[model samples]
Target chain A: MTAHPDQTKAGAGRIVISVDAMGGDHGAATVVAGIAHSAKKNPDIGFILHGRRDELERLVAKRRHLADCTEIRDAPDVVSMDDKPSHVMRHGKGTSMWSALESVRNGEATVCVSCGNTGALMMMSVLRLRRLPGIYRPAIAVMWPSRNPQGFNVLLDGGADIRADAKDLMQYALMGTSYARNGFGVARPRIGLLNVGTEEHKGRAELREAHDLIAANAQTSDFEFVGFVEGRDLPGDTCDVIVTDGFTGNVALKTGEGTATMIAERLRDAFAYSPLSRLASVLAYTSLQRLKKRIDPRRVNGGVFLGLNGTVVKSHGAADPTGVSAAVKLAFQLAQSGFSQKLAARVASAALPPQDASSDDDGGTS
Target chain B: MTAHPDQTKAGAGRIVISVDAMGGDHGAATVVAGIAHSAKKNPDIGFILHGRRDELERLVAKRRHLADCTEIRDAPDVVSMDDKPSHVMRHGKGTSMWSALESVRNGEATVCVSCGNTGALMMMSVLRLRRLPGIYRPAIAVMWPSRNPQGFNVLLDGGADIRADAKDLMQYALMGTSYARNGFGVARPRIGLLNVGTEEHKGRAELREAHDLIAANAQTSDFEFVGFVEGRDLPGDTCDVIVTDGFTGNVALKTGEGTATMIAERLRDAFAYSPLSRLASVLAYTSLQRLKKRIDPRRVNGGVFLGLNGTVVKSHGAADPTGVSAAVKLAFQLAQSGFSQKLAARVASAALPPQDASSDDDGGTS
Candidate 1:
């Protein structure tokens, strides 16, 4: 095999990330711009851009650096943000989202990044790539901006599917821990089961049983169990990964995002309230920018779907180029570390023999 | 009955609120100071202070307004924050929390306010006052600061009990609507069932059934059902009352509080980053204060326990005088509106025939 001079210098393998340049609220131009941003920052990254060939070509033509590192796959159709997952499974034959996942499934790319409908993306990914062996359900794990030494926490089952039994939660803990290790390079991630209270006797029956299961398996799983944690701990430094049913995790994720947005609006309104305050804002502009940088949602943009046979990162549908780049960057990192293979091996080694398997009826609905 | 000059001028009846003065983190001094603050603002308010007489007397000594409006009732025991609700129930006869609830039960006070252990307070309230007719479960409703014209939204069951079924969620909707209408004067309050997504087909089976029940009863129940709402809507104007099971409500509440605290600390740090920024802070101090006051949890301190025979407001255990005063003020307003009776009437009128009453296994556990 002939090795490129660039690859030899870094001595790291080249990573080809599949990009679905369609269905984002901002459209394909923004996604192409994001590819440009990633290519400018990391020379080792390559992309197989999935969208209408002519349009992608025009957009990539503007960025010569990105064009050199990009491969355009002619997917004639686009998945609308409002497209139903089931409908997409039947009709999304030549859509960018479909082609994007196909690349990962066919070994052309190690990771797929899409700023598309999350439900549709998950559905197509599952149909094409399948669930990892012994994995009951796949969960969308996202990085929560936190006060931890690593500056983030991993929260999963972020609305991949709403229902989880005691066993599914255990899987989430293992999957989340694996993601934290491969994606963030955290050694022996601390896992916390999200509950209403930190006490043992609190929350539902399933949560209690799941707590015991996680604690019992933590050592063998190569992670530390921090027991039950409340929603407040999502952004705290006490744990690296918070595992919960998708219903709660999704609500908490949206709640946190909404809250951050609300505060940002309020702060802006405060600064713009009076002429004197506006003048003060000018003086403190740099400090305010630093604060914004610290809490920027765009910096932690990707929601990586774990417990699946292949890696797929779901960028926010409304993401700008910066947000898309953040998602692409995460995909690159995970792809480089061979996250999919490591995750499969972890699940195969640590997962219990599907005890109480019948309890997962509620999980398969959606 | 002869009316006092203070009561006759307002043409409104005087309200006597029972206070559990012993269990708060700041003790009787803070409770007395809160009463003083409330009494100074509203002439028609009175209090029945429950605690050690000598301790209460010393704290009330400096507050002339509180002294005139207060009636002391000696209760020797106190319910510590860590005390289990069941333990408190078995041996809490002389505790201030017990006495406070008893005052409401015996018709000596219109409302009860306690800054004690929440689980203990909930247990005592259920034990002494009992659930209202046709109500299967009682819930704790809190005021979340929002962008609504009312400036706040109502959220419940904020840790009253963790488990809720379909019928219980329907009852929460009716009860929360009643609270919003009577307590906040929101005419025909819009109710939203809290879920992972606003889609009709999302969430657990219970939530979906509850959505249908709420929608079906909206016209007859005298409130608008806004369908399912996400956690972001808790702080948004789209809904007035967000109804959910206690587990989700409690987690969302704490998560919002934690996020707000994190942002506030970051904002402070930003302002203190440099000398020039410190000077800018001085200039923007007033605007910042306004912003702070707008989102101050203390300003909306009380968590009103609904669907009970009597009104019970649980203040934060660590509440300072300002926070305590806010809870007291809420209790007084609720008392004046005859909110307890109104809620009981609403529950009695709107509740279904308790079709799935057997599902409430943990309803009375606390």
Candidate 2:
């Protein structure tokens, strides 16, 4: 679906993003501050801030530029982190999250951004915006800070659905490649199927089948299929888009983040261990700060929900103004570029013919 | 089976480890150097070195201690890295890898350690030593360098079977907990079921079933069940043993190692960026070295094959002398403690009762 018909006449007009300014761990103030930060940086960005009208007006009034470009919607309810997705789908009406997504669904906004419960956000987005045609599942693609030249790798489904079959994995490849191109500007993204080992015969039978399917479609899909890649390859420079089922991708993402955090903490403690080390820390302060910034999780804080009719960016619930702003920036970029429409077209074109039992051998060559 | 029945009277005597000095990427020299390194540190360790006699004798002759402690077996053929397990099982006779495991099968050594083809070694071990009773699928358990007090966590099955059912995961729990207790001396080891989310409602159905199975038998199995732990917990201080199906565990293990290595290289490059950073490098050299040693992959360099009738340690194919030595140390520790027999008893004790059609609901309380 395209944006408002009136806005289409202006080639470089403002893009409005619906924001759910409630349910974040840091409260509504942090979310508003994030929007203010984005508004100051991007002149063409506009927002439909959904939350309590009085609070939204007060926060926006504090930032003149944000107030000029913002519209307030009065939504009384908030989605708690513990709310069940099913419960949210069934009874979560009039909530800020719901109203924000409804803006995207009704052509009022180009993209929807939320710093709320991920499960509830995903559930509400799918229920309100719906899935794309021929797309069985909607995957959440995350940007993993990586050794690639682009400094990141796209990994999905990052906890959207716990399972993916050969067909689903092929669909993920199409969606992830589309995201990598639109989201990261990688002209020819390298798509890799995440397996236990890079070898052809190492993983499950389904993976082998998926490999063939992905390899068979790589040319038409306009992506390079790097065949199979191992877990260690995720943060390495081997592939641009590391495709896996949601279960494995989610686990790998959190594990990598946890390990990086632990090591950073240990390095900090090591620098403070002795007088000489402390002196070294002072000398290495600039370089260490640079390295820290390069690897910081806050720099890339959103997980984009793909394979859906509307684009949804789920920011970390505990995100500060900087982190939330980073997410809003991504949502704004995607919305401006019409990423949802492009992704839908890619998925539709890449959709394989219905398979019987015998055509499985077609995905053999990469 | 007791080792060298004739030496039974000695009681607290030396332990012999079967060594397959072939199929490693570093060649036979690295394996020999690894043995020599282990022999220098340990007085009560002996080896049954399996390889070509001429090459073995020449290498052992250079190290007096290794020559004194090693019993060389003349095995001309070598198991190639490309050899399939089924092929090896049928026609891999007279190979160094086969002879090495035969030592353990014949009770000549307490444990078998190999730097050979993983698939071939797994097949040969199961064929030669057989599976422990009540163990349907054998698993490869790796020691993951972690932030735990023990400095590592035991994760399995690390590519044993790409597919593990509920019963297999439960077995992995028993086997992993047993390994953590005996290998790391983590008394009353905390066992966690690896899942996408920590919540009871997340992940595949089998994980839920395994969670119930593990939790229900924790007291009897003598492990502290930590409910569901996410991938982040793999390197965090949450659990001692993280249990998952072979596929997930393998991917997670490699992913952690890969991410750690990439970061280490990036950190090193950051320190060497400029003259000021170079000077900072010298200042932080000692502390950085300590941090490097704390997270070095070489320190914990072996994947122990669990749930089998005999103990087998698979060293990294590209390991250097130091890496190989770490694996030897692990093999020596397991041999000294008679870990294989203890594991057998644990498996037998934790064996599930015969399931009726309706009583399969036992694994649901957690």
Candidate 3:
């Protein structure tokens, strides 16, 4: 995003972010605090907070600068984290999540930010904003902290749908590349297909065909196809975007997060093991804080929906104010760069090969 | 295993482990050193070391106890890590990996432990030892360090074969439970079917059917069924066995390992960031070392082949002496407990559901 963070003046030029304020674990107050944090950091951002008017207005009024740049939309209902997507789709009329996405659908907001039930939010997103042309499944791309110079890599299909075939995988490659380009300003992104091994003969049959298909499209797509990458490469510097089906991608994403959290916990325990260690921890506190900042999940908190007509950032349902603020910053950046439109344009320009409307032809591996 | 550590006598009642000394990253010396380490700790373990005669003799002779408990089996060939499984199956009759499995096939050794190529070892294992009757796919179940009472969880298939259906996953559950019972002494182990979500409505179609099938057979199989666990649960104390297809399992395994390695690296960098941290590192050495000992990959470094007539342990290709010793220790435990016969008996007695011979019926998710 070329938008500078210093532009504190709020008015018509501000990029509007539609937020579903009712669904997060900490309630609307936390969401309002997150909005306030973003408003304090970046001057050229505005928000349409969707929730109960009295509560949201009271929260927003506490932050005068936030009040100057924010409008509260009255959404009487709330989408609980446990609500089924089917249930939500059937009777999700005045819910805050729906109201937030509707703002994007009606062109009243550049993007929508929600910390609701992921499945329900995604379902409502497809129903309201719609999938792009020639796209079998829309994917949710999350920024994974990596060893890359950009400090993060784009991993797609973070659980938009459980299954993806050869054609769907190929579409993911295109969308992921476009995401890296627009979101991080990477000139020419490198793409890798996630598999069991880097060998061509390995993995299931669909992955092999996807490998060939992705490699074949590399030249025209204007991205370097790094053939195949194992799960280890997800956090490594081998590629800018790692693509896979939602089942595998979601599992890997959570596995990585869980491992990181476990290690951090262990490190904390190690520091607290003895009096000497505790003293050492106090002495090394600054460095530990620095390390914590580098690997903090809250620092990179949004999973942006790709292949949809409009962009939506799915913040973690349990996110605190800092996490929410980071997600808002991401939404602001994507809106500033017009990520959704460019992604749509990229997919339209480079249509994937039609091998399997259903990937039933690959009988051997899957 | 109930094997006593103090029974270091090399004569009668000794359990012989077949070792492939030709194929690890380090030479036969390291393999011999690992054997010596095991011998130093446990006296009732014997070895049939497969490699070149002269080198094995020289390395074995350096440690008198290891030399006394070991017999050299001269196999003229070596299986490089890059050798294809199919190629090794056809032309690898006299290779050390081939020779190592034959010992188990002929009942000369209680179990086989190899630091050779995993795919080749698995191929040779199936051809030589054969799969247990009624078992469709032989899986490689790995021990993942976790917060379980046993300090680890069993995850399979660790890339034995990429695709697994509802039936395959059911078999994995059976095999994994048996493994936990024998390998970790976890009686009536809890089995979790890996999925995108814990909700029954989530994940691939095969997983849902597998969930039902595994749930139904839990009581008969004598194990607790924890339905639908996500990737994060692998490290948690929720279950003792995590069952999934080879592709997902393999990816999760490597992804977890990679995350650990990256964090460890960052911690090192963090400690080295400044003079104060360096001094703090010195002060916290013992606590840090204790933490390292708890999470070291080498401490739990074996992928046990399940559902085979004979047990086989595939050590990592780049494993060091500590890693090799860990694999040897696991092999010893399995061998002492007659894990192979018990697993075969368990599978033959409690059969899987009859959904799909090839899982072709599930059209929705793969």
Tell me how many clashing residue pairs each candidate has.
0, 1, 2
Give model 2's docking category: medium
In model 1, which regions exceed 4 Å deviation?
A: A1-14, A25-30, A54-65, A79-84, A348-366, B1-14, B24-44, B52-58, B62-65, B317-320, B348-366
Over all chains combined, what TM-score does candidate 1 have? 0.89
How would you encode candidate 3's per-residue C-alpha lDDT over A16-99 as one tens digit per residue?
888999999889988989989999999888888899999988898888999998888899999987678899988899999999
Give one digit per residue, the lDDT tens place, for model 2 in B231-266: 889888889988888788878887778778877888
Candidate 3 lDDT score at position B256: 86
Give the whole-model CA lDDT for all candidates, comma-separated.
Answer: 0.84, 0.83, 0.84
Where does candidate 2 clash, by residue pair? A212-A363
For model 2 the local lDDT of residue A305 reads: 93
RMSD values, in order shown: 4.7, 5.2, 5.2
Q: For candidate 1, lDDT tens digit of each residue in A1-366?
A: 111113321224557888999999999999998879999999988888999999998999898888777888999999987777888989999899999998788777788999998888888887788777667778999998888889889999888888899878988988988888876789989999999777676678999999998998888789999999988888888899999988888888777777777778888999999998999999899999998887877888889999777899999887999999999999888877777888888776664655633433443333
- At residue B268, what lDDT does model 2 achieve? 90
Point out the worst 10-residue segment of candidate 3 chain A by lDDT: A357-366
- The TM-scores of all predictions, comma-separated, are 0.89, 0.90, 0.90
Residue B314, model 1: lDDT of: 95
True contacts kept of each: 0.62, 0.78, 0.68
